[model samples]
Target chain A: MTESVLASWREGPVKQAIVDFVALATTPGPGFVAVADRIATFDNDGTLWVEQPLPPQFDFVFRRWAQEIKQDPSLAEQQPYKAIIARDPAFFAGVATQDPEVVGALLAAFARTWKGTTPEEFDAQVREWLQTVKQPKLGVPYIELVYKPMLELLDLLRAHEFRVFVCSGGGRDFMRVFAEETWGIFKENVIGTAAEYRYADGRIVRAEHALGSLNVGPGKPEHIFAQTGRLPALAGGNADVDIEMLEAARFSVLVSHDDEEREFAYTSGGEASLARAKELGWTVVSMKDDWITVF
Target chain B: MTESVLASWREGPVKQAIVDFVALATTPGPGFVAVADRIATFDNDGTLWVEQPLPPQFDFVFRRWAQEIKQDPSLAEQQPYKAIIARDPAFFAGVATQDPEVVGALLAAFARTWKGTTPEEFDAQVREWLQTVKQPKLGVPYIELVYKPMLELLDLLRAHEFRVFVCSGGGRDFMRVFAEETWGIFKENVIGTAAEYRYADGRIVRAEHALGSLNVGPGKPEHIFAQTGRLPALAGGNADVDIEMLEAARFSVLVSHDDEEREFAYTSGGEASLARAKELGWTVVSMKDDWITVF
Candidate 1:
């Protein structure tokens, strides 16, 4: 047999599903999809890279929030700000519980930090953070924490003429900074939540509010439609926030974090997604069994 | 010498400018752009296709408005609807004058017709309109009115590995319907003004309001940065609305409507752009002088 594109993946259901789908898509048969319709999208944070202890974007924002609080002590009393400053375990536990209130509070705080900057300035800030900051556990730049096997999957899809897009809940500009270098995806192919912008003084500057919806949960499919005018043929994600996106695709893959030694093992936030994968007969990839390496 | 990409174009400053810019971008020289950064954006209306008399989108909206008015005669008295229904030449004259109030009124009417429809439904509507409607003077479908020279330029740029995008002031979903077949550009590469969408009942439906800024004037560069995260290396346009987009690019080309024999000729809406083109030493392609063919 010819070598498989997903060489790092073991001989298992996960690898077999991908190989079979690609074969079906590329071969001249009833299931063949045209090259133009071969669009694939992946959830960025947990699916493509590390989103453990904290999402890298949250870490970046936390440092900024801490500095803001230090400069203006009065700001520390704000509910979410106070919780972040104190490292309140209860507040973080709420995040782990996937509490909507806590997540909204966190996003509100994150939005405030980069509200008024131009997109170019925001990208520059993100590039600086990516250069200086390292993931706490991995001790490497956040981009380096990307899963090796998943990267291979991305390449495999691209080899079959699929246009891969990184659809993330993270800031669109933040992901664009490193997407091209780390993922070999074009900046235009990175879709995420964005702040509104207005033209003033011969330049476009970011408005303090979001454009409309966040690129999470149902927003994923909404954005994919708004931006590309087509649903992805293949979609992958790792959490409940990505469930709607996966459902919109013809082939859905969910990554199960069950390998504590190689990666953080968690079944709390992604419980619904994991259950859905099983219920719908979607491909659920066990980190330990499906991949020979984590990063 | 080898055959030139723009063979139909008569040799002049405009043709030379395009040829020089492409050579500089592709060769190993001081201004050689990497393949990844070779982005070329074009304005959709007059720059790529006919916009005289009325933009083809306005024609589509006008028909929709007429249908809306017939169903609800009460709408006929509405300010913009009244103006459109009466076929008031003065009202359209204001559009040529770039009257903000008149343009805003027209857009408000246009939005009401398409809002609440799912993207798939919106695209289907646009596709139907394209099939049935033909430009009054051109006596051809709107898609066929696209400039033959511009089509050649797009193909040439694609051959050089430059990613070309259509940035328009028209509706995003409306353009995606025909961009792929008409221009040899994919739906994802077409960027324009978009309405906000909400996920409901397992499908995304357009919200009643626009997401943010219209993709016109300075909004062109802003939307380009927001969507693609990069400025265009080369840009083209034909009217004042596209001046800022051209200003944002490294190489700018403005198409002047001077071929009254073949295409409608007007220097009114585009006067400011023509003036700026002259002042900035930008390439201004005179339709009568520069091209041997109009369509």
Candidate 2:
């Protein structure tokens, strides 16, 4: 039964590339070598999972911000807050491209708001939020909507003795909230953007996270190299920004979204960024032609 | 030959604890718990290496300060600068204990000073310092004076499938400087006190870490629990501060410095601290009885 399931998915060029990668990683030799200690890095938003109107993290954050604004009317006057209050998702996402200064300021505000708590305190709040929050599109728990394929890939890589890491462009603390339970990736291995913390008065205090540019494609590889001092053995992505990270990997796979019937087809939209992974020499896995299942 | 070398060492209760730890970790289980993932945490400084007059890290910091001061004599007139110029090692170590406000103010000053640089830049500077710094007593490079027996134990644990880590009172950044080269322990796994960083001007800017209370013995367990969320299977320590960490481990070992004639016999001047470890029923190993070589 398991062999039939595996064989069912093994019918494309991308599948062949995956087979080759698995073979090299398992085979022991000098030339076709697989470094046992090798790590494989994957991008989160729009790569491993879906990123439509905005990433799920931003959706959660904005929702939290809206709740806070109800308690304090003054935040409505703030620039980014005002943009958010006006329900301008485009303006908020384009804050980096339009006026970069706002990005840093917004990040600082976000960091200051959540700094200096114990792990228990933070985790409890995250758990509470996850229990309460629901995805508008799916009408299900946000955690349930996590890409099933990526979860399987994570398990498969770990089985082969590969250290798989999620090098996301999302907030480190935010990603950490669900990373362990939802993905099985530990907090230490999950690298992302961070807000600062200040310890004082027998308590952990949040410092302003001077946010500016999110760690996108090229920056993903840069951060990984800085933290781990290693280039990944395998890398996966689904967008133009991910090209740099994939190019740096020994084996690269690109998931191309072409199944409109099974999954939402994303080409390029007025608000959303265009996908450009095809030009990066990545083994393109078409949703319709490559993957047997969307999940 | 290896057995003979181990037999030459004095036997102690902690030695047996280590043996038991190795045995339990290697025993196969449902999830494939192997020695490579056993994850043994160790304390650095007095535990793994010599830390007499002051930790070697402080020595480097003081020397660098002096060099910087020589180039700018005006620093002699400044408050902490004047104290630093006085060349009082005791005063320096007691800076926080003596005046809590001074530590906070100094950390603030450092945060402003280091506002825009990559982690790589700081790592490079630390590497340079390690290359130049020599231990006063051993006359060996500070990095080389790491206890030979402990090095073997790390290798043995790794051989048995244990992931060796450092959970110390020292600065996290300091451990990262040499853990990889000296012990094959990656920087991420070595949890310790840390200074916060801020992102500014396209780089990760480090702030001064004003550690109010060091991650001393009991605090060592706190650090490990808070950071990694995994209680170690085994831990080794040299002094009273090691007791808490040792106590938290499934199998704990304390290196008793009873061989005054062979190696420097010393302990942190705190009786109650070690007494607490004894009350916890932890395994204590006499160095004279447990180690064949002092390195």
Candidate 3:
């Protein structure tokens, strides 16, 4: 027999389940899914990459906020800036848990900071950052940190005629900058929280407001449906906020972070999610146990 | 010497313009657009199909309203229902011209009527209406009323590696019902005004509110950008509401209804569009003089 495409994934129930699901979905049987019906979506942050040091998007934004404070001292009066300056553990805990209120405040500030910028201008900055910004602990560029096993999974899905989409809580435009290059997903296939855009004088610019609500919890499925018009046949997520999207899928994979040596280990945000997965009989993947490699 | 793919189009500057634009776009020079940048969007109502007598969506909605008024009696007190009941000329005129206020109120009612329905339920109704309900004057189902020449244009654009999308003021779900079957465009390629969806019980349902503001004028380009992250390389439209979308495109086609016998010939709604087309030097297609066949 030819080697399995998921080389990084160890031969276990977790990997076997994914292989079997694809088998039933592709073969002509009760579980058979037509090409048009084969949709797979994944959460980006913790599921597909390292999110423990904080989600990459938050890091990307925090760097800019740090710089902005140097020029505008009064800006630290705001909730996000204040929290960042004080290194408040409670605020970081809220962020780690994907607290809706805290994330909403951050997104509001994010929208305001980039307002009036054209997509081309915004794209250039994101691309430049992706190539240069190193993960402090990893000492490598951030884009290099995208999980290898998840990419293999994405490939396996795509090879089976499944259209894969990256549904994230990150800014749509921001993720889109590196999505095509890093994940082989196209710009249109990346759905997330987005700035509401304005078109005037034959030009398009980012508006101050977000396009819709945050892409978390229920918003995942909401944004997914708005884009693809159907829930996924298979979905993968790792944190509490991804619970709703995972619940709505035919098969759910909840990645459990338990390998501190290879990758950071914590159940900080995904505590409830891990419990829910066990209760619902959803597949729980231990990063250290299931995968042969981390990066 | 090959017969043109746009066989329905008469030999004219309008046809020549399209032919020249495609050649330039594909020739790998200053005008050449890479496959990724070759996004083409079209306005669906008067541009892709007949919107007169009334746009097909309004007719579909009006029929449902007529039945509801009989059951509720008080529903007729509402603006859309009351306006439909009285067959108000001003309301009809407002709809024809794509007035934002009239469209917004009508969409508000549209969202409320189908509030808690699942996508499957809403899709069933739209598909049934498309198959069974005949256009009053056309003596055929509304789906059959889609313009053949415009369809040829879609095919031509696709044949040239352009990813064509249908961007309309109608509900996104509604357009998606027949998008692939009728236009050969996928469900995800349809962008339109839509319901805010709710997810619970592992099921997604349409919420009471519209997804965003009315998809007319600036909203068209905004919705298009929200989906694809960039403006169109080529675009086609037929009314005032499409002006912004068309204005943003590198190449724009403004279809003018001037064939009374072959097709309806009133530019009542497109007067401003026609004026803008002239001002912007947009290619204006006169149905009477340009197209050899209307359907």
True contacts kept of 1: 0.67
- For residues B1-295, what per-residue lDDT tens digits would candidate 1 score against the true structure? 1476788788777888898899999999788999888999999899999997888998888888889889999998886889887889888777655578886886677567766877778778888999899888879988889898998889889989999999998888889988888988889999998887777666778777776677888888888877788889999999998988998888899999998889978987798999999898888998889998878
lDDT tens readout by residue for model 3, B54-96: 7898778888878888989998888888888898989867764
Task: State residue B104's C-alpha deviation in candidate 1, in Å.
Answer: 6.2
Candidate 1 vs 3: which has more DockQ: 3
Top candidate, metric DockQ: 3
Classify candidate 3 by CAPRI docking class: medium
Q: For candidate 2, lDDT tens digit of each residue in B238-259?
A: 6665666776666676666666
* Candidate 3 TM-score, true structure as reference: 0.94
How well does candidate 2 score on lDDT at residue A108? Answer: 52
- Flag clash pairs in model 3: none
Each candidate's DockQ score against the native complex?
0.63, 0.14, 0.75
lDDT of 3 at A186: 72
Worst 10 residues of 2 chain A by lDDT: A269-278
What lDDT does the true structure give each of the candidates?
A: 0.85, 0.64, 0.87
